[model samples]
Target: VLAFTATGFVVAAFGQALGIDTLVVRNAGAIILCLVGIVLLIPRLQDGLSRIATPAAAWASRQQSALDDRAGLWGQALIGALLGIVWAPCVGPTLGAAVALAAEGKDLGEVALVMAAFGLGISTVLLVIAFAARGALARWRGRMMAAGGRGKIVLGGLLLIVGIFILTGVDRQLEAFLLDHLPDRVTEWSTAF
Candidate 1:
């Protein structure tokens, strides 16, 4: 996730340096399109199609075993990285904003810090969930299982909504709204940069 986010920042910075208008919004749209494509193309993901359709038992077992292992901090970091990569599709908006900022061609230090902040924000939520996951899973295994059964339906609905938003150009509307409402000072600053 860090790597991906950093890559996005760099791309954005490069775009800004080139004086690209709407760099953020265009790139964000592209990223979302990429995610949609990946989800459609990946056989495993397409087959599962829903949280309920996922092999929760097997996944939970694996997570439990991995957590129980006496690994060092590096192992945890690696696991976290892997998890972030796997979860990237779900984190599109946050990353897209960070990258758009990076494209504004900020100083290297600033860019690094911004990317780090973005990573930290994402990691915070994930870490909290990971910490409580085991207990939550154990206590609500039955309910979770039932939820899983309806996972595909939920996922399909979400995908439908996302598709409609994208196809109907809602992103452009959002971009226009933001740009129209930005403080004059910020717009001036962006142009000056």
Candidate 2:
């Protein structure tokens, strides 16, 4: 995850410096490519993916639950990194600005800190969701499993839409809009470094 974040930050910074209007598009495209790579390696990910990518039709299949086991943090972290890379297109905008700033190629330590902070920000939200919404997610997972092939199709379609949104540069537009309308304090802080 750190390596992926660092590479993304560098790409964002380089794209900004070079006046690349298609940075988001290219990044999204890269994300799609990464997902393709993962899909191609499904044999390797089968065990981990099976738990997360539950078939919708089997929503009520009474599968064994392991949400609270907490026995595989390192393994989970590795899988999470792989998942992050595969889903980058859907959430690229989540760190677009921070990445752009890190890409400025300022101090190496500063860049590392900024990337770390970004990772923490992401992790904080996910942890909160995991803790606070476990029941809801489990229910949703059941529903997804019940939906089965249809559920999978819907997910695939959603991914396609996300891909299209990224390819169309919606994220960049949103980023620009936010930057343009940022509050004075945010603007000042963002410009400080």
Candidate 3:
């Protein structure tokens, strides 16, 4: 999550520095996200993606093994950080869009905050699953993988729907409405941050 947050911030900053039009970036990001959803929904596309990613994964595995043989705990940490840097962007479309949206404000702090919050949310869920459901997950691992396939489809459809919302500008309208209706204290707190 930390690595993701840092990468997200840099991406936002780079986009801003390039003077890219916000609407264009937002639309492009939405389209990319929708494409990712489509890829997820299609097994053939996933297989293709896997083939493309296999080399990278294999390299990472080898590096992990070498690190384990040499650098001990510190090497493991380094490899983990390297994986996070590489892995985050691949899995970051949802939060990437959020950070891109936040970038429209031209506020680096806001972008960082959004990325941090998103990372924290993901981390919390993963930690909870790792710690609280380890046994149950191990017992049901096979079943869970089957269910996970269905869950991926559902998630893909939802991403498609959200992409449409963002593209159609409904997301902005909803955000505006929420902001308009937010309590003064909430608004004030956010601004203060």
Candidate 4:
């Protein structure tokens, strides 16, 4: 995840150096996010994904365990890495914004720090949920299973709001407003990091 974010930062900085316009990027990202949101919110698409997932799971279950414990460990790590990329749409904007901020400095060290911080922040949430996942899943399995079909709708609703904000420029404006009003102490603390 750290590597992924670092790469994003580096790429953004490179793009900036090549004279790509930030406004163009912001608009493009907003449009893509909105489209994704629309697709997710479509009931038919959710139904299609569900239909496909079942057969795919059954096929996977039928496959023999080809890997020993050691290989299995590495295979799982690889799968997790791939899954992170698959999940990037959910996180791309925040990372992009951070990358753009880092690019302003044109300093490789600053870009690395921004990327590291972004990765660390995201990993913290993931770590907390992962640590508590077993218990949560065990306790809520039946309920979660029951609600599975609706989960996509819930996620879509959230993404729709985020997309709307980004599309209308409210998201960036709000971020800028917050930054302007933020306490110097807080900014200083972050800089200390």
Screening candidate 4 with a backbone cut-off below 3 angstroms (N, C-alpha, C), the clashing residue pairs are none
Ten contiguous residues with the weakest lDDT in model 2: 60-69
lDDT of 3 by residue, 1-193 (tens): 7777787777667755767565786687689779988988999999999999999999978978998999999896776567657655554455556556665665777777877787788779988988989789789999999999999899889888778888998988987898999998988897563
User: 1-193, model 4: which lDDT tens digit per residue?
Assistant: 7546645665666766777676776667677766666767897875777797999877754542443244677766665566656554456655566666665665766666666676678879999989989788999999998897588677767777877887787887998897799998987886665
lDDT of each: 0.63, 0.59, 0.77, 0.69
Ranking by TM-score: 4, 3, 1, 2
RMSD of 1: 7.4
* Candidate 2 accuracy as lDDT: 0.59
What's the distance in Å from true for residue 53, model 1? 13
lDDT of 1 by residue, 73-134 (tens): 76666676776555544555554555555655446566656566767776689879999796
Winner of 1 and 3 under TM-score: 3
C-alpha positional error of residue 52 in candidate 3 after TM-score superposition, expressed in Å? 3.1
Best prediction by TM-score: 4
Better of 3 and 4 by TM-score: 4
lDDT of 2 by residue, 48-90 (tens): 6666667752653332123224435765565567665655444
Between 2 and 4, whose TM-score is larger? 4
Among all candidates shown, the one with the greatest lDDT: 3
Residue 172, candidate 3: how far off, in angstroms?
1.1
What is every candidate's alpha-carbon RMSD to the true fold? 7.4, 9.2, 4.9, 4.4
TM-score of predicted model 4?
A: 0.66
